[model samples]
Target: MAGSSATGLATLLPGAAEAAQKGVLTGFDLARRQGFPMLRHGPFGLIANPTSVDATGVHIADILHETAGVPLAAMFGPEHGFRGSAQAGKSEARSRDARTGLPVFDIYAKSGDALTAIFRAAGIGCVVFDIQDVGVRFYTYISTLFDSLVACARLGYEMIVLDRPNPITGLDCAGPVMQPGYESFIGRAAIPIRHGMTVGELARLFNAAFVPALAGRPARLRVVGMQGWSRDMWYDRTGLIWVPPSPNMPSLETAIVYPGTCLFEGTTLSVGRGTTMPFAYLGGPEVDGAAWVAALRRRALPGCVFRETYFTPGFSRHAGETIMGLELIVTDRQAFAPIPTALTMLSDALRLAGKPFWSDGGRTFDLLAGDGDTRAMLERGVAPERIVAGWQPALDRFRARRSGYLLYS
Candidate 1:
């Protein structure tokens, strides 16, 4: 996966990102070796979900237990639980690991004091976080990672992030930074909608900001960077397997369209959650499938084609009833940015249909995009290009700012 110089790096990637992953050492794979810099710590605790496995399907937890003589103090689970057995917003009930007898701590909803008790009981020397991030700001994995890091910093525990590929690559940044008042669990730090960096890179961003935010108590953070990982390379290139980070996000296709398709969730439409093809299809009772697709194409939005489709989701909103919507077919990733494309269709929906479309409000868009300005500009009769332009100044500044943390060449 690790290629040569920036020329070769850009050659491998599909876009402007001009670098490749290191060939010798991968972020997670490095831990498998005996005498790596990060492995010397004693009695380490793994804060990983199910996806924390090696290339050959070896679970990281099992690898460390077998290889290093490190005692497993306790396991920490993120939103979907340790094994990722539950769906979104759900986690496993506290249980002992049958094989290792390690106590599992739930950190998704228990970020503050309750979570702190678990860490204290575990008495771990370091926390290893190895989760694949999709490079979107609102995704909860980063939040879970953040809370864990914050806790580690507060108590002076070590944080070792085993880096993984950012499935959305890690170069092109889109949308505006989250404003002050809008900082929720979904949008805590000010970053674009599609932030192009790996979990480790995001940790770097956090550590730098924490140098100030922590008020002199910065996190003892160390990242074991990925080998053969280029910021521009997608999952298919790595020769490593792809694991579903959540129940709804089944495939890379689902992930690619997610940052945009997720916007539908905030609306009355079903973003294909209950069915097998979640985030790939969208529909609601009132949506005009053909009309919406046709009207959306009239603008000739780049890198995307809308296929008029219909479906009945097994669960979630608008379930058990067939509804109509457009299935986005992305022709070009470089030319086709999901955030801008989603906002355009939203604007067109508001323009073509007045109260019915507008009445539901842009709440879904607001939550999905993590900002009101983009959606607001569209509501106030702004064109998609202009709406995108309005946010570019901040977006550009962020792009330049984020360049400081680029891991790959």
Candidate 2:
């Protein structure tokens, strides 16, 4: 576990401090500006995606390939391909990078000995991980990170993480902790659904808390922490350009509602995938848009409004068939509670659709919820408020456990 430690706030290069006064500087931004000092451990393989770029939108793989003295041996892509060409739950096949000509390996769905072999075959002793995360436990990038850490620890290799802002802000956390026996690629830890942590902070937590038990020791890790980032600053306020981390997660608006609405994936509802507004629009063929909106309006949820709408998705659920549902319009992000809001939406949708709403008898829903109790409560027609209230004790424990690993104030 030598060199297994996260750095404090990165040092700003000359003129960078003044530039940072205007907005936050990401770990990649600071590393690039400071001349890629972390790449000193040469012949490093990079685990990255389309979101791994500097402030000027320069891709890290390309920059590393051209940088002098930095031996970047290969590239690794997560759920999305390195260039982000694939869709959800898919990745591009192994190929040579068009720009850098570096060999690209698909690390999506890879872990344990299979993943460690990938690292061994790459002929590298270190891996640099950089990807934008939306701060939800089920988002999958963090899962990729966790698997990578375990593999690195097994192989006795080093892992350097380039941290980014949690687009939703790390002010609070909610939702149920992922129970044991429910570990999937979407969630492999006992963390809350809306895990209010950056990839760097999660790396620290994973290395210290979870990696040891799985790998027999912690990974030799280092996190290049971001400068100018605060716990309360959302990605929009950080002055960084939005790069879609996945094909479906196109905008920050989609990410804001994803933690809760993503639970719909385990249901019969079309979460607006393959449409212009995924996650923001929720509906199905049986849904009554007008009635759903009216019921939601009666609830008077904070920081958001529901509008009756109709959409025909090009792909994924209700394709080419116009479905009735309501669009979620978040008015004040600061006041919007995504999990509770979504729970309310789910309760209302269940009342409208009945048992059919629980796709696969709530198996997938239970996984997405991190526990089966949520689906069970919803099935019993429990109010979203009571369901959310039941989560406070667990949430409080998680928050307290999470505070010690937090890097940013």
Candidate 3:
């Protein structure tokens, strides 16, 4: 029920990338060139949103509809709705697309027999997923993908995933692995909070690792992988356009810090929701901006700097009340460790904000953190570093298990 974590700016341009100049072509682009012949078999559904666009900024649904005999039977919207018009915790009502005149259904929070029934009623033989993910566990889009996989496996429907870049890059994994009994809509498995794999690769992992264990078997899965993407290439390096996957995720910088700072959504603090800075700005009404900034600076977190700041949100936590917090300045994308930095920030914030620091009765934080251990450890006066150290073994095991699913080197 809570949102994601992290920080970023809109000004960072994508022209300074390290990859080749020819640009990375997404699965949707390649599928279009191949004439989408697979869809010629009657009807298939697309799970997409405003972010499912080609290199020239044309929507994939539009292209498929216009292509001769493509057979795009229906469209599906995830958490925020198909056009991404709805805000957090809400979705657009089921309606027909004004442009393509195709029926659009809402897939958020629907699963099992209910979900399979939707696909069957649409008369879709296959389901294609093309949403861009930020590579964090609590983002919900991935959770929707996980649920869809289970449903498809149960109903014997084929599933195709059009792979996209991990935006935050897929070179590493960090944060706590979700423990059993701690599963929520935000986390459906025991993977690390930052699972460091693209959606296609995750689909493969889900089919082989999670689905069989829970759903009784695997789905018919196919992943159309990217042509030139590698584990080290960041979003800018992909040479693709940046479409905000959600309202708050305005740029790639936002995605980078998200796996960490997004934990604030579970707290009493204002995670810059109504401000132009959003996740980049964090604080609460009781916070001492200067002291909090000083405490965070002393941690010497890599790849980032912190500054004392104050703001009043037009919406969400502490709205219209001026609050104090820190502004994250990311100096080195490659060096900035988001989970550690965010844990340290939380530790400092809790210590400084006193008794009423937490909100939602702490359930939200526990769910996003993937278990009760993080919140429990923090409440028991544990150092942020010590808490992070406790997750090493589990994180290591997850990394090893996930390697088999990696599509890019």
lDDT of each: 0.72, 0.87, 0.84
Q: Which residue pairs in model 2 clash with each other?
A: none
lDDT of 3 by residue, 1-409 (tens): 0111111100101221433656787777666656775567778999999899998888999989898888898999998899999877677889999999999999887877878889888888889899999999999899889999988888788888888989888988999999888787899888888999999888877788888766688888777767668788899988899999998888888888888999988898888886878788998866788998999888888999999888777668888988878899899998999999999898888888866777878989989998888988887789989999999999989988887667677
Cα error, candidate 2, residue 276 (Å):
1.3
**Model 2 root mean square deviation, Cα atoms:** 2.9
Best by TM-score: 2
On TM-score, the stronger of 1 and 2 is 2
lDDT of 1 by residue, 1-409 (tens): 2222211011112222322442324576755553444656677788888788887777777776666556667788888898888877788887887766778877776665666677877878678788877778888889877777777777777788888888877767887677766766676678877888888777777766643364245567777666667667777677778888888888888788888767766666678877778887876765677888898878788888888887788777877988777788888876878878877777665665535553257665675577777666776888878877877888888878777666676
List candidate 2 stretches off by more than 4 Å: 1-22
Candidate 3 — which residues are off by over 4 angstroms?
1-21
TM-score list, all predictions: 0.89, 0.95, 0.93
Arranged by TM-score, best first: 2, 3, 1
Q: Kindly give the stretch of ten consecutive residues in candidate 3 with the minimal lDDT sum.
A: 1-10
- lDDT per residue, candidate 2, 1-409, as tens digits? 1122432222222233554566888788778877887787668999999999887899988888998899999999998788999888899899999999899999999998899999999999998899999999999989999999999889888888888999999887999988898999989899999999999889888888899899988888877778778788888899999999998899999999999899999998899888999999889976677888999999999999999888887667787889888899999998999999999998888888744887888888898999989999988999899999999999998888787778787
Runs of candidate 1 with Cα error greater than 4 angstroms are 1-25, 34-37, 211-216, 352-364
Clashing pairs in 3: 4-262, 5-258, 5-261, 5-262, 6-257, 6-258, 6-261, 6-262
The deviation in Å at residue 269 for candidate 3 is 0.5
